[model samples]
Target chain A: MNGTPEGTPERTVRVVIVDDHAIFRSGLKADLDARIDVVGEAGTVDQAIAVIAEARPEVVLLDVHLPGGLGGGGREVISGSATLLGSTSFLALSVSDAAEDVVAVIRAGARGYVTKTISGAEISDAVMRVADGDAVFSPRLAGFVLDAFGTAPADIADDELDRLSARELEVMRLIARGYSYKEVAKELFISIKTVETHVSAVLRKLQLSSRHELTKWAAERRLL
Target chain B: MTTALQRPPLVRSSDRMIAGVCAGLADHLGWPVKYVRLGMVLASFAGGAGVAFYAWLWTMVPTADESARRNARRPASPIAPAVSLPAPVVREAPRGPLPLGPLPDGGAPPFAVPAPAVAAWFRTRRIQYGKEILLGAGLLLVAAILIARQFGVDVPLGTLIPAAAILGGAAIAWMQLDETRRAGLVDKTKADQAGGWVRLAAGLALVVAGVLVMVSGSGSWEQTWLALLASVAVLGGVALVLLPWGLKFWKDLETERAGRVRETERAEIAAHLHDSVLQTLALIQRRAGSEQDVVRLARAQERELRIWLYRDAAKDAGLLADRIKAAAAEVEDTHGHAVDVVTVGDAAMTERHEALVQAAREAMLNAARHGGGTVSVYLESSDAGSEIFIKDRGPGFDPDAVPEDRLGVRESIIGRMKRHGGTAVIASSPDGTEVRLGLKAADTAEARIGEEKP
Candidate 1:
């Protein structure tokens, strides 16, 4: 009991699926049924906001593109349901590997992102981690973050908040190489908790650096 | 999706001499406004049928602004109903718009005025050489008729009116059919303009001579009415015979346009498939574990699909980034390991750029063959030059451990870069090997502008 809590004592995590494809949502629900309780589902921005508000699931798997609402896609769903952010978490699930799309949802306050190609087990794992207040960074997202924060071997960054410490970059690189958190800890000769801390630090930089390069990236892509 | 857009609606034009009916008809039929106005005046002198037709058209057609508003309000594409989010919506097959009934000539106008202002003025005043000559001729004809009447040779107005109506109607119908036939023929500039004027003059002369003959050899009112009704029935029979052929022609044009649109839609679908399915396959290859054959098959399929989808771009694959990808794809095929290429910007291919690509290729081959894990190739090209990093995650080997003859890392990668006036840095530790290849541009001014603290 005194040890660190492991994800709310193994209770099944409640989740909502938000995708335009009904077949994909049903398939994903069947795959995650053992660990994840499918509380509700929605297909568009308005429906996603309504369903998430009503169910208040622990985690919501959101598609990056959806019809309805000012054409903002998943980012609109997140912002439209801002009040639920304190209780529920959002994880962007998309087929798009576009950097602007990934960064836009993250900036709009998604806990993490995972591509649709991820195995059901991996996605369930990501959902559980997000439910436990941990940020999930897929390999592609890590690469995008590295590129945005300028991996040019410069310690002093142009923007103060956008700077990644030497240790954070190492953690990000290992993650980008498809290392699990446990594997990253072993590779870096650090504890699993320390690996989490470094990843969290990188994530903070990713969110904070929004005003600098990431915002410019989204603007140049006409995402704004 | 409507013939409303294809066939310009018979709206009253903004350019007006009186009611703008003639101007709008001129625009719709692709004819000169002055000629259309003259035809309307001649028809009016015959029986006032022109006034009646103009009123019917003005009441029937919508204005341009109303049509624009209606089009704007039409929903572009139907949005899937959200009530059935748990089940996919079944959509009905799209129906093609039907071709409408034939109207005036579809040919482009011959005398396309170069400027709008000048064209408007010409339409209203028509103060050119032809107008003056027509006015003088009209005055001479009136004087001759008046002198004849004074000499006791009366012109029969009653028979003349009926004959003029029939002749004028026939002339307009013939001119419309002639214009349609001419539209199907080859387009000629100077010849078409001259021929158009000649045809108009001939048609008018024929109508006027026929009316005069009917007046001089006057017939009773009942016989004139019977002849008009007979001509109408004959023209109706002719139209019924040609209706099917005209419908077939328009249908062919619509099918061709629809086919072009379908082709573009197909290209978009292919791009979408590449983004989703190809990416999914790449991810599967990364985690396929014991199913090496499955992973290799998926990788090969993905490579083929990507190349096929971007075949047009591959024709001019001279960018440094494209060359690196071609090399990475080669390594992936031969060594059965995945190579993920992420490029920032592209530069034109140069001889030194070829060295970079070759060195990068050697580094990738070493990583795939020896490293035994997925290789990551990152290329960044700026104004100054290009920088490529080929990194792998397998257990690294010391450079000194390799024998003299097996000098792929030292000779093929590092040596190749050195000979090409570029620098290659090999950093191998217990974690992995990272080969950084940098090629500086020869332009000093650009290099200075792109200078940054290394």
Candidate 2:
């Protein structure tokens, strides 16, 4: 979005698509090939695999739980081909992001995963993310990953928090670590009243009753 | 402590070692610990039956100390926390004088649950899923290769690689009928055993069908006795077997989830022991540590593990809230959150239905994520009807969000939903978002309920 214009003529994103529905594949390819970057397309995993292995496209766009059947050999193709997921990069374009399908493909190490109903730009962006070595996952998938991982009750608001001034949290940590007002003031080269004010505000916001309890809660939350 | 109060028996654990209730009695009375143990073991041996007594003691007595709650976050002592590794335990310095409960009168409890059990389950799940995908893909590849050759599209794998590819795709898809065994992975409330039986039955049928097709070479199994035999034993037994045994995997998940249940979380102490101090102890046990050190460390870990488990118990009490969320989604058009409201009656289950469900879910998710809207859905209550609506308030652009991105108003909203006898409505406003779904439901009451509910 920065250097690239809205239609910046950069290297076209090469893509190989697969779907069991031939007409569906044709329609999809027409959309992609029309964009000046679609290298090849196939209607089944085999054709996609062969095309991907041969053409080595920048992105191997996939459709989950394809129209065809699945079992031992079908699973093997997905897993074996999974090696290319993080490298040559496989992007799942699926209709179902059911926890089973989403988690299954993710554990196999897909570079990017989105449903087929996604917009062309999102699909294009997924391809770009895969091309750029960044992992891409739909929003629903983000929750799936967190659920599957069973993340301990930790703050998952990292991106939002990153934008805020770290200085504020740091000041709160110093107070929680038992540095009294004057001491905190001395450490930060600020007035004792400023330290007192900050401590007062921190306690109020975190909703702790006293300084002692504040430190305890902060310690347990690893906020200190 | 008096003998009666001191000598509570061990709860159900393993055999061989008693809860040492007798030992507690001896220690309290300033007598040899072995005397009490021998008396009980002998008591059982004489007539009560030693093993039965052992089991009973395991059931009756607080294994370590019924009151000595191990922390759910860690192991018994400061001993090995991780399970795979062996680390020595160490006696921890007491925090302060305390009454009993999580705190020990003499010392913290000295027990730890093995760790590998929990981690290994997820790891096993991952491996199994990989196996399934690899198998599925391989089948497709072989078929696609055969089809290519059959159609003379090239790739000389012999006759009909092209036709075989098409059939293989069918065979591969037909094979997925077995993976249905994985449905309850996220939901614990489902009566899984019954489902497991059904899944096993279904899987076996699928496997038999697959094998019959592979080996029987296009024979009508209904007309042939050999096909029937193969279907029942080879295909049915094998596919059915994975479901029953795979049931352990399901139970393990339940055990993990129980940490969130009040009744079940009484056992969360075990997992806490595993995750924290147990994990730490496992690390310490292998390294050189004195017996006294291991004992002390184990005591510390037990307390820590106890604190963690109690805290986890508190947190797990609300785990039902998640299921509540899932249920709510079923009635509403929630995109970011999960909700599925579908009427799956045999003949009605068609490719179009699947495509519609998939498309709606995808678009709704996108609108919620990018278009900046709250996803709300209502399945129209009519004959086999469903109505879904997704609305967003983001800058309602004239053009679609993306081209290859697919879930545009076309493929995602109209095309797929339309196939399922459903309609997808995408309407965005400057104020906010909304999508209305009109779907055919066998029981309009179900769809009407979604609409009428708050």
Candidate 3:
């Protein structure tokens, strides 16, 4: 739950910023310093992995494009820090709204994705959510997921692993249509916890599908 | 047959020997340069006719570059215009909303060359001779001919007859040069066609003349037959020597064509970027004082460009998705709100769906006016029906609280859908409002069949 007593200063989310732009990192660190603890910062993939490893931050804010590490960028950082993935959650922060890069890092184990244009307070909220073990889906990411999984219920029985449950589909659609988790809960007549559970379940199915249909879908569309 | 009237404009070639007169003549008449030079030298002895003609050609012929520039207006045919970049994604400064779709890349065939290899066989340069080397050979040949004439070393009639036959045969084979070159370029002007006919006829006349002289002047028919056979054999030998050169020429043409395609693609991409992204960046910079305006401009441009890039994949998305996108865009532009549209599957816009689109547009307009931030529009067209969800993160308002005159939601969205045999559901709470428009398959036969299946 995001609700916590204001008196507990130790409840600040430990975070690492991974972006190639130093100015962006500094600006973000300054903006997020009030609510989030900026434990480490890195500008490249190798640096990101090293800093994340050293800091053992609760959440890593990663840029989709990085200067190093086999040219896979944020995906490489997430995979490289696979050991820390169990204890440390990774959240993708990018300026690109491209589906390919977003899907790539998500497939590589990013807990959530938020665009760079997001406000500092909003990004802090996303960080806290990821730190709380919840999958944060932006409207665009929700739309991408809906497109990849396909929203039609007719063929749901054929592809068990790739299909989204009816409830999950409803949740994803609401999110895609720019509904916040709290709003989605209110609209669906469910609790905020239930909304988070549905999103987490969808995220699990996205990662667990044998054939990453998301990547294939994006590739087929030449989004890659 | 060899009429000089209406001849192609004689141009001095850059690839030349001496004054390029002989090479120019060879090019126009489809004869070998060496043979034409030798013929001219021999004709010079006939009252200096060849020397006078060469001087005239040197004075009259335009240089290669001049000819090339002059021919700029000439139809460079056979190459269809480069695949036009999908007619600039017509973006209208959003009065309301903009339409979206991908332009199909398949526009025109890139090159019309029938077969580069085959065409190259006739066009390839079989001989590469230096200017100085050709000049030296010409001088030596002239000296030898003059010396022989002075010594009165009577050349045998037998040798002279065969030499004539050989020259005639060579001319006949050379006629293919211009014809094939025209074919290769695939831009045969009427003059070139007429010239080709004349060259063929002249070649035929020469061959006939050579045969008649050999038949009449020789002592025996066997000698004449033997001379003709030897001429044919020489032509075959020349062809054999040119085989590798033809192949090389073919390869060169292929490489050149590939390069042309790459250049075209690069130019198209650059033009698109300049028109869309660069222009948007300029607009953003000009309006930099307002952060909101800058963000709005960038976001709209980004969406338009992305849709254009993925136009191919979106091509089959049909009218439903495009209509919804346009609706979302209209709201965004008019209200300065961000609308995210994601579409899955597509179907034809049946009459019933018109109500669906209108309702969705109304919903989006409401959301933008009331919803403070980004609005999401998700459209899915499947076998059953098309479903559109227009959700907004705004302070929820009760449908009944609004005055009866505010017919936007009640009359436009809800009433419009109900009249068209569709359903509209509005879910509003403290969090936000979601307007779902569902239109069942009224006219789609496929959907009717799909419903029958289960």
Candidate 4:
């Protein structure tokens, strides 16, 4: 993929790695492909917010448990930069697979969640996916997001599910059930790029984290 | 016969049904207590003399306190009588003192009293019983005077009765005035410490009797003044006896208070050790790397110490699951294998729970050592019992092919569950291996019953 076609110049994905462990950040930075640029790094919530704001990276890899900033952890970094949320997306890279950790980061507006054990290539691909406005998740963590938000809508407030447009709801259920952007697009008889726009709108309406969490949310509610 | 000179026989206060008088007499005379008691009861039918004699013995016999004091003073004596007497003698020696040969007196009695020993014994007994004898004589004299008056003989009842009262009170006061004697009496009847009212009443009775005597006396005022002085002397002696007892009681209270404070401080130190030392050990167990085996050994020690410390804390099932997860994590870290632990339901960590955990841990180790990449542990519990499953995706082995000497499977896992009234089932094919350990509540009850029967 890095061997771009004969004439066009390659565009690198601008990324910021935020993690508490220095060794993990450095190792990840070293392992990432040349097509991805690690523009900045931060170990704490405040530092992450500051670096993300200053670097204006297209993708921020966040750790769920960071040292500072109102004790909000990774969620603080996301909420602290609300204005940047429109232009900059987040992909959470954490060592924890705990259901609450996954749900918290997702609800705080991370576009995906993956464990530290994932290979560097997978992490790079995940970064590109999040930068392209697509949700990514490690296969195991998808179940947690589904279980948390996928409960029957009868138990949820009517307005919570009712706020979505019919088309957005269809997109949500499909995306939440572990469907990729291309798969959701084919299923809905829509263009692949249009599917991304609908997913972004569905995520905004439902206040969810990523497509993996969306699959969990839809599966838990038995919507798919 | 034991000589009184060796060590005066003391009333066994702890062995007493009522003042230990019979037991003491039996001890001194080397007679069975039942026989001595029977003799006293039979003698009591002869004009009530036995009751008075028993009371006299109760009053004069040196109590345990006096015996201890005597023992303390004569350290050179081989037999410290009080120290030699076993505290549990009353329970063990219910048959009473050993019987000797027939007595020379008349009937073939249970005890034989040597002639010289009896004479020497009486000689010493007379001195101890002297005040009681005097009081008895004084009572007889007053009775004789009253009888004389009843028969119309000219006898001054008031003067004679008051004189008897004064003599009896003086005798009691004289016997109890010595500090050692007072301590002996106080220790024997601990109730006397609260008997101030009784003492006051006795003093008031003596003064009333003396006042009557003074009113009826034909003698001069000097004789009446002498009787009043005697009454005052009796009251003063009673006060002297009570003073030392009160001091001893106060000192004992102070000692007890100090002991309680020291106990509280020790308990506080124990609580501190529980929190700090155990917590540090737990942290080391989690963080230690290449020292994983040492950490596990320390963790086991910590668990035992915790069990000993908080013995009454109920072991929750959640904690059992947590322990299993921790064990799996250790194996994962040490061997570079991935283990996923999942738990369902909650219960108390009973013996069955512990057995399941141990078996599961063994299974996990087996999987990590011989099986594929990722191992999964599942723990589920219900009201019936708990179940644990350890699965690995490694190439499976035939159960029959296992070496006879390999105790990891045979003893650690299978034998453990069997002992706990549980079952361990292992399934291995070329694809993977899975071990399931199951414990049932009914089986636990049966195992307990089986244990009790044997």
Candidate 5:
């Protein structure tokens, strides 16, 4: 839950908060726990990508609307950092709960989505979840994702779900349904390392940045 | 005579209705004011020709005091006593049916028409009257010859008739020319019922004469049909002259009516806004501590304004649901509660729809206040009706336990639905509480009837 494996020391979760508003960034930095290190901050899509790549933070709190760089907003920041996707996971912290915004960022590889009205503690928890490879969304945003990616998988022939091997699909469904990696490995009679490999492959094939987005993607399509 | 001719006409403001145009015309033409006004009213009924002429004359004439001021401003030339005086003296002249005294000095009113312009006008009038007289004499001679033939009198009709017609036409032409030439030197007097009255009476007489001609011609129908036809044609020509004025008046009246209707509608909207939205805004201003309360008031005002501006757009179910979700989001943010809004199917956005959303919002607020955990909202709509359910997973209370002063439930939720002819049913137990608000399509009929009552 704290982004550390069992038997390991409690390590700080390195985070980079990306938002256009300076006051919000400062307030959020002030509010978070000392255990969570604030590595860098960025006000635009290009700055976000550059800062995330340079800092190599474990979690990036990205806003949906940014000033510059491709004009694709948070989606651009996420897609622009394809090389850093394996290491740095993104949790969208935006003021918009618009369905299109939530779905677009998720489809472009953000780990989760939350509105700006969320309490500092809730945002900190979401950051830890994204760092620990879990999909976290504000309550209503999950419905938006679910509605965007229709419930029935019958219309998902060209969907990322169709590209995964059956074994990977099995691991995806269990993980998306909130099972830990060890639990998923145990369910499938595979070693933890093999499960991790399959998860990474599924993430790559689906263009997902982390296990969190993989879960959200699978959950939205109701694969769970 | 020269002094009398120098005086200008005045637009008699005392005896006037709607601009003094008729009175002005009467004073300028040396006619009795009452007869001129009556003639204008009759002409208005006959396609409004008199109204047009009166409006023209109104602009052309000067008011009594205005002419007097102008005369005083000018240097006094050597003129007789009457012309230099103001209009009150002229108005005091004897109110006879005929224009009294030497044609009022036989010159045009200086303000109404310049001396050179009057001379030209008289010249044209003389030519027109001469032609009319010549035509009249020709028609008379023709009629005389026809009557003779009808009476079986075989007199030498051709030479006698042609000679008499020429001589009479020449004599009439000579008299009109001489009068017009004299009118240039002096103010030409007008009869009591000149201008508009003469035109109106002429039109009426022509119509009556046509009817008589038709009735008399019925006996020797074939032989005398031309006279009847000529009279009818003249009546039609007169009617054509009045048609444009009547059409113009009709158009003006229609535009005025439309403008009045628009004004009334605007006033109604202003009153409604003042009564409801403005009052709520004022109350919110007084109680400005809570941001949530302010937000709620602002959202209510926004919804009202949007409905007023884009009523058609507000009627779309999708847009309505979006608005409700937006309101729910604001509540969740302000209260720090998790609200899950799930909508199934579409319902038209009516006043009933608005009522249901408001009731649902109140229910959410109640649950957030009295209960715990996530607040869940479920909206199910079908052709029959729409049902909204707000649920909270927490300890519940009895409805009767609510205090008498708590009007949130009594007015905002339950009363709202009842007003819209819908139902709000709340069920609660120790584990959880759910407020079910149902609005049937049939209830819209009742709501409409309620609207009609006020």
Candidate 6:
């Protein structure tokens, strides 16, 4: 129930292979098995869901259109099938990479989407990424995704204080040293009450939080 | 896909709001319109918001009559924009109306037309479309700018300008295609017109916002962020929305251009054919006694014609120099000695003009050869009609004097003159022979507009 240590390699990534086309599934299974031990290979979504429940593969290679796999006599959009795959990281395998197709799948909970025309190596990489909880998408689709959802800034610099006086730094260090209002007053030869005022001034100048946090931060950075 | 769309719905295929009409129609057709309408409604509503739409319906129950419900299940054909024509269909291999046999002779026709069908198709429609595109683009530009202005917005135009320009140019281009399409100028398609406006709108909005974000002291660059997002959004949106249409437009343009080129080549081939190969075939047909003989002789003769037809002629021989000079001189001086002409060595053998000159010179020679002569030559490049002639005072003979191996009668007199796009005629026989050669001059740049129709 507890979290593993940083960089711990304790968990095995399970995978489920699903495709309506038998030959494709068989071949995909052989490849996945040889590369990264698949939990189960299901020829259809029905079998795959059953296998997924039984084996609990972390990844499922979800086909876009699964014939008769929707438990109905008709065909549905690839998105409908995606929603049925549950929380298992769904890596979409399809022959279509149309902008609409890519967006539809991603919007349908597919962790990764790649065209079937891709080489075995690329497919393997895509599968691995999806299994590892990373979103894999084609370049255009990725752009579309970023376009639809506002993009986040990659770098955020901390605010700078350009005009703080040099005496402010000494006052900030002393304040960060965990000295009491009275102790700092004696150490710096300032009035005890004057020390409290300097501490307040230091907080405002350096944009630091309360004195307790400042002490811990100063101790970590060797600023005291 | 086209065929699938043709299928009629259970309802009136008029609207898509409810299941009543679909249900009634389904009952009539022994099918479930309710389920069908449900599926269709689900599919249609799922386009952008399926869940939210259903939830809204669940809360806001409408009080409508049963008959109105019947109306809702029908498809709304009028609301949907007409499907843009499919991308130019890639024609399968074989070209031309029919394999009218191999490339014909007498060199290719000089005035070959470019895609006549495409030209003819776009001739009337292009101008109308181009104007629409222009109007739409202009309106969209004004609207977008005014809206942005109204909102107190500004944006950098550097990036957006290019996109708008691209659209504007495409719109204006409909007007320019007349040269390729023959008499008809630009015809913008619906897709083209829409795309142009959309482009202008997107560029204007995004650019204005982007500039505002940069200049004004906005709280957190949200305007610039949105502007950038808007620009990208417009690009993606327009591309996704108009890709098939734009592609179809481009393909049509390309095909039209291609059609023009192909048509030109075909015309050239036809002209060459009519001038030589066709004439030659006609001769063989008349001469050959039996079908078998015609077939056998045609194989050899056709091969022979195709063979010598492609010889290397000199690049820069002064073709028709004598004719041009003689004709130019003829316009001024009327009563000159019957134009006496001479041909020096192989002058500009490869020049197409040389062919006309050769024909003219041959006409001159034939006049002297047949009946010594009073000949006159006249030519005009700008003033319109171009002519060449030969006249001499000699024992003027009649047409009856055409002897066998008569180069003048067979090749020069008839074939040569016709091949030059002119005719050779005997003007008078009053103590002198006068031979005249005249050809119609092309008013504009000599062009061919022909396209093969399947």
Top-DockQ structure, candidate number: 3
**Worst lDDT 10-window in candidate 6 chain B:** B99-108
lDDT of 6 by residue, B237-290 (tens): 988998999899988998889889899998987887787777767877797776
Give one digit per residue, the lDDT tens place, for model 4 in B1-454. 3344364455555577688877877775567889878766755564444454465456545677656775576543222231223222222222211111110111111112234643553575555434434443444454455456669999755465566556544444444454335465335455644454355456556645556575647646677677768867986899799989988998998888789879998998788777767676667766677565554445444444544443434444356766786787677656756666655544566677777888888899999899985676766565567677787868999887889999999999999999988999998877568788888876666768898996
Rank by lDDT (best first): 3, 1, 4, 5, 2, 6
Question: What lDDT tens digits, residue by residue, belong to model 5 across residues A152-183?
Answer: 23334555553455676466444432234565
Cα lDDT of model 1 by residue, B1-454, tens digit: 1322344445467898876766766765557889878866654444443443344345333355544543465532111110111111101111121111111111111111124533443574454323223323433344445457679998865654446444544554565456546455334467655766776666655564455447445566676566656766876898899889989988998898789779999998888778767776776777777577667667766666665543443245678878998999999888889987766657889888888999999999999987856687878777777888788877988877778888788898889898988999887777678788999886767566778635
Off by over 4 Å in 2: A1-8, A30-36, A67-75, A82-87, A153-224, B1-454
Steric clash pairs (candidate 1):
none
Off by over 4 Å in 4: A1-14, A33-37, A53-58, A83-89, A94-103, A111-224, B1-318, B329-345, B380-454
lDDT of 5 by residue, B158-275 (tens): 3443344344434444545554564452344574125434544544444454345444544356544666577679878988998999899989988998898899999999998897
lDDT agreement with native, every candidate: 0.69, 0.45, 0.72, 0.63, 0.62, 0.45
The candidate, 4 or 5, that scores higher on TM-score is 5
Docking class of 1: incorrect
DockQ of each: 0.05, 0.01, 0.31, 0.03, 0.04, 0.00
Candidate 6: lDDT of B439? 57
lDDT of 2 by residue, B1-454 (tens): 1232333222222232445545544443445667656655654444333433233223223334322443242333211121111101112211122221111121111112233533443464454334323433453354445456568876643333333434434543443443333332453335644655554555544444444555655556565567667556765678787987789998987787875686556567576557786676675677436654554455345434434432433334322222222333432333333222221111233355455456656655665556552333322222343333344435654335546565466776677677666776665445444555555554557768999988
| Residue A67, candidate 1: C-alpha displacement in angstroms | 4.8
Which of the two, 2 or 6, has more TM-score? 2
Judged by lDDT against the true structure, how good is candidate 4?
A: 0.63
Give the clash count for model 3: 2
Q: What TM-score does prediction 4 earn?
A: 0.39
**Structural RMSD, model 3:** 18.1
